[model samples]
Target: MSRTVFCRKYQKEMEGLDFPPMPGAKGQDIFENVSRQAWEEWQNQQTMLINEKHLSLMDPNNRKYLQAQMERFFNNEPFDKAEGYVPPEK
Candidate 1:
């Protein structure tokens, strides 16, 4: 049977991840509190942010910035947008 977690992002009980996403305390926290669906969504957003900002994971500062962005994204806090990216005219 699949596992369930109280997804912090969705604010509902949902299917949990099969394994810890990261390596340590934060990964355990996510495993205990975040849902698979929410994690996937964050992954997609992270990809876009990385590509848009031309972030190099090899750089320590870049990794730190991405980690901060990930936290803000999951917590429903405001986050940075790609430079020069404008919303489509509504």
Candidate 2:
């Protein structure tokens, strides 16, 4: 066997070994559980924000303004000539 392997096999007898703790010495999934929960919460908040923005963009008054703008352009009116259409509830 290689000298390094032989020496490590009896490393406890050397009296100067400084090996780190074996895996799971403190607890398993300590950092992993915390990180996973944080990531899931972040994803939920992002999804909620995205859904709110989508709903606002799809609102009726916003759609009306878009339609009016398109109509004005199709009728050959200058874009600036269309009346400023404010959102109904805003």
Candidate 3:
């Protein structure tokens, strides 16, 4: 059976990630607190931001910006979105 966590974003128990998404304390915290669904959603948003804003992960500043945005996303606070982005119709 999969583990369940009280997801920080969804605020209810849900399926948890099999492993930490990244290294270090933040990853551990997210593994403990964030649900798989929330993590996946964040990844989608992160991709959109990177593609739309032309953010390069190799740049330290860009990485920092993404980190801040990720924190805001998880906290349910206001976060930046890709300007003029429209989701593709299904």
Candidate 4:
């Protein structure tokens, strides 16, 4: 059976990630607290933000901005959305 966790974002028990998404304490915390679904959703949002805003990962400020957005996203706080973005029709 897969591991389960009290997902911080969903506020309920759910499937957990098999491994930390990154190294260090923060990654470990997320591994224990964040659900895999939440992480994947964040990845999609991050991509949209990066593309829409033309954010460069090489820039420390842009990275910081994404970090902050991630925190807010997990906390259920308001976060920046890519402007003028319309989801493709199925």
Query: lDDT tens string, model 1, 1-90?
Result: 999999998899999999999899999999999999989988977887899989999999999998898888779899876777666798
lDDT of each: 0.90, 0.35, 0.95, 0.94
- Give me the runs in candidate 4 sitting further than 4 Å from their true place: none
TM, every model: 0.87, 0.26, 0.94, 0.94
Candidate with maximal lDDT: 3
**What tens digits encode model 3's per-residue C-alpha lDDT throughout 31-87?**
999999999999999999999999999999999999999999988999999889888
After superposition, the stretches of candidate 1 with alpha carbons farther than 4 Å from their true spots are 83-90
What is the Cα-based lDDT of residue 17 in candidate 2?
A: 16
By TM-score, the better pick of 1 and 3 is 3
Better of 3 and 4 by lDDT: 3
Candidate 1 residue pairs in backbone clash: none
| Deviation (Å) of 89 in candidate 3 | 4.0
Count of clashes, each model: 0, 0, 0, 0
lDDT of 2: 0.35
Give the higher-TM-score candidate: 1 or 2.
1
- Tens digit per residue, CA lDDT, model 4, 1-90: 999989889999989999999899989989999998999999999999999999999999999999999999998999999999898999
Candidate 4 matches the true fold with a TM-score of: 0.94
- Model 1 TM-score (2 dp): 0.87
